[model samples]
Target: MKKIIELKQVYKDYPLAGISQTVLHDINFEVVPGEFVAIVGPSGNGKSTLLNLLTGIDHPSSGQVIVNGAALQNLSNERLSLWRGANLGIVFQFFQLLPSLNLLQNVMLPMDFLGKLSKTQRRQQAMQLLERVGLADACHRLPSQVSGGQQQRAAIARALANDPPLIVADEPTGNLDAATADDVFDLFAHLRDQGKTLVMVTHNETLAAAASRKLEIRCGRIHADTPAVAG
Candidate 1:
């Protein structure tokens, strides 16, 4: 089967006071469809940078990032935005929901941006996604009105707005309590079971151990890539 996510000789660098500092060094990996991949590493060890590369938010200094059959590095910004909207969903740690828009509108925003569905259809699909994430009744509440977990659920719903094939999350449950974090993990597992490729950067060891595959990064290199012993 074809790879859903591939990074070839990936290296990421940033300029610090005129010198280049490398964050990811010669990274290479491939993720197939229907895989739940958890990336675990120490703080500031290039985990989030890797996710940014995969999601097209940041470009690799020199490498290829192919996701959902599209070479991300080859796409123009405009095309990349469109492609990302249709092919990938990102769940953020902070639950980056628009404060003014209620949960329903937040979930509908992606569909609106893509414009593949009518307003009515977007609403219907958004409602369904909200329900899928167990937030149907709270759909009308503002992000601030709900608990942190609820907001994260809304973020998940919004991420699924376009029915993207891949989901990339960066510290998605970092802000939630233990019980709530487990709930979010369960929801992600459900998505994985339904054939969505998931790659998550997490600090939670238990969650990492529960994933189908676990990758450990250290000092800008992948130290280990092994099948997770489910806990």
Candidate 2:
């Protein structure tokens, strides 16, 4: 498998009250093509911070974050945005869809930014994704108009809009009911089977158990990295 992401001796810090506080420490990690990885830990253990580093949304205080063989720290903000837009898809627990855009428009936003496709092509592609997520009818609806589960499905479709090679979600199932969470996770599994690399931060051990690998974080450090047991 091709290595899609790598983090070497990475550390991240923030200034709090005139003091430097480290949230992540000496984190070394990697993900290969088509792997589904789960990140788990107690609250405030820095799982989200780790995810941000992988996506280039945040930079490490030291060390390197290389995705698709490019070091993220070497890019300017403008370049990083473009690279990330084309290479990574991010999903948030809160379903961070634009309030003003309808579901179809939200899914098209990434493609719109990329501008490699014509408007008609973008629309057609977005509609297909929305339909795949069982949101065909809701494509014209605003995020507030849909149920939480529906919103999350739409978020997944939007994540795929740019057709990124990697997808990362922080607490993807955190806000949904058990059945709904399962459905969302099924989407991730399906993506993994289709050769898209996925990394998700979740508290649900049940879902974590279904991933190809699991990483347990404790006190801002990786406590364990193991292959998840298959049922």
Candidate 3:
């Protein structure tokens, strides 16, 4: 498989009390196309930071982040933002839906920003994504009107709005109950089957176990990198 995302000798630090504190050090990894990878670690171990770097939301202090063979460090903020919308999808623990927009409108938001599709075409694509996420009937519902699980599913639909090749999820199921989390996990599997590369931050061992590969982060470094076998 071809590499879709790569981090080469990456390091990130933050200034604390006038001293630099390392958050991620000497990180190097590659996410191949159509792979499902779960990054696991305790809280405050730079899991979120890693995701931010991968998505081009934050820059590494040193080294390079290459996505689809292009150096992310060289892109301007506006260009990076546009590139992310076109090539990368992001899902968050809190769902991050717009409270003012209904499910259909929220899913259409990304397409609106892209400005590459007609209004009717965008609506059709959004509805199709909602159907794919099993939220067809909830299209008219507000974020507050849906259950937690349903909201997360809607968020997934929105993330797929532009049909990105890579999806970066940070603790997507953190707020859901076990059963609901399992449903979301199934959706991830479905995406994998559809040839989308997934790099997810998850605390649930069972969920992580379902991935093709697992990575453990500790003390701002990769502690373990291993392939996981299905039971």
Candidate 4:
């Protein structure tokens, strides 16, 4: 496995009542290609803050963040967006599909923005991804028309639009039933087997434990980092 994401002595601070409060402290972490890493912690432990840094949605106040070999601190905002669009696939908890677009259109939107493929090619690629996620027949349906699990599956396919090596999922199964969440996790596992790195922030201990690597956070610090076996 090749190292694809790294954080060095990272810290995040936010202003509260005119005083700075650190939400993440001296974080040091790395994720290599194809590993499924679950970040688990209690509420208000900065799990989401860490995810933001990883995805370049938020920058660390101090220290370095490197993803896919580029130092994030150095990229201009425009460059960062370009880099993210090209290299990282981000999945969110709410299945952030455009409500007006059909599943196939939603999946193709990323590729369309990246403009790496022709119009017809984008449609074909998105169709293939939807098919892989078991949503070929649902492609024409709006996000509102599909079941929660199917919508999540479509979101995963959209994340794969650019065929990125690293995937960051923020509470991807937080809103689903147990069986439905299991189906989503199975898809994630399959993506892992296909050599796509996954960093997931999850509160579900059962789901987190199933990941190949687990990082436990407490009080904005790493409480434990360990390997785990998941069924």
Candidate 5:
């Protein structure tokens, strides 16, 4: 399999009270194309920080973040932004849908920013994605009008709008009830089945077990990385 993402000797630090506090230490990992990997740990173990580094939303303090053979550290901010827009799909714990935009509009926003397709083409593609996520009937509804599950489905649709091969989801099902979380995870499994690479940070062990591989991050390092065992 082709390597889609690689991190070597990575480190991240933040300033606290005029002192540097390291958050991630010497992290090393690689994600192959079409792999579904779950990252789990207690809160503040640098899981979200790691995802931000992979997506190029934030740079590593040291070492490298290579995606698709290009060094993210070397890319200019504008170029990195463009690369992220084209290649990285991100889903957050909270559905980051625009309140002013309906479902269709929210899905179309990425295409608009990327400008890779015409307006009509973007709308058509967004509608298809919404349909795929089982939100076809909710396309015209505002995010507030939908249930939490429906809104999350819409967010997933939006994330897949560009047909990005790599998706980074941080606590995607965190806000939902058990039934809704199950449904959302089913959608994630469907995406994996379609050959998309998924790197998710999750607190739910059930959801983590659904992934092909699991990694435990603790104290800014990977304490374990292994395949999931069937129960």
Candidate 6:
């Protein structure tokens, strides 16, 4: 199978008061299908910047980011948004659920945006995803009505609504307590077992070590890329 993600000589620079600040330097990365990869680094060391590039939330200053067979640098913002809705599942550190929408509605939003399924089909699939995340009973509750863990679970359900091949999470369990974080991490492991390509940016070393591979960043560069010691 083709690589699920590829980045060649990627550099990301931002203008700060008329000076270009480089956040990523000559980053060459690739992820094969079904691999669970963790990116860990110090604060402000470009971990999240790399994730943004992978998700096409931001573009690199030079070089290429090809994910799921599409060169992100070549796509316009409008096209990138559509492609992301169909090909990538993203989980944020803070659950970005629509407070006005219930859990089920939040999960259905992606399918709604993609519009490849009917209303009935979307609802059914959303419920199935909520069930998978152990949140089916709470599907009718609004995000504010749920606990932090539950909100994150609903967010995961929303992420999977489109059944995208790749899932990119930025500190998915960062805000939860130890027990709750473990629960969320378990769900990610289950998804990995089911053959989703996952790239997670995390500060939890324990969780990072459990992934199939680990990439460490330092000083705007990849410091290490090694097979993790499976926990």
Q: lDDT of each model, Cα atoms only?
A: 0.93, 0.92, 0.93, 0.92, 0.92, 0.94
User: Looking at candidate 4, what is the lDDT of residue 132?
Assistant: 98
Q: Per-residue lDDT of 123-144 in model 2, one digit per residue for the tens?
A: 9999999999999999999999
lDDT per residue (tens digit) for residues 66-104 in model 5: 997779999999999888889989999899999999999
169 in model 3: Cα distance from truth in Å?
A: 0.3
Colliding residue pairs in candidate 2: none
Task: Name model 1 segments beyond 4 Å from true.
Answer: none
1-231: candidate 3 lDDT, tens digit per residue:
778988999999999999999999999998889888999989999999999998898999999999977799899999998898899889999999999999999999999999999999999999999999999999999999999999999999999999998899999999999999999989998887787888999998877887889989998899999996666
Q: Over 4 Å off in model 4, which ranges?
A: none
* The 10-residue segment with the lowest total lDDT in model 1: 203-212
Off by over 4 Å in 6: none
Between candidates 3 and 5, the lDDT winner: 3
Backbone Cα, N, C clashes tallied per candidate: 0, 0, 0, 0, 0, 0
Model 5: residues >4 Å from true position, as ranges? Answer: none
Best by TM-score: 6
Error of 5 at 38 (Å): 0.1
> What are the candidates' C-alpha RMSDs?
0.9, 1.0, 1.0, 1.2, 1.0, 0.8
Candidate 5 collision pairs: none
User: TM-score for model 6?
Assistant: 0.98
**lDDT by residue for model 4 (177-231), tens:** 9999999988987887887788999987777877889999999999999996665
- Model 3 C-alpha RMSD vs. true structure (Å) is 1.0
| TM-score-better candidate, 1 vs 5 | 1
Per lDDT, the best of the predicted structures is: 6
- Give lDDT: candidate 5, residue 47: 92
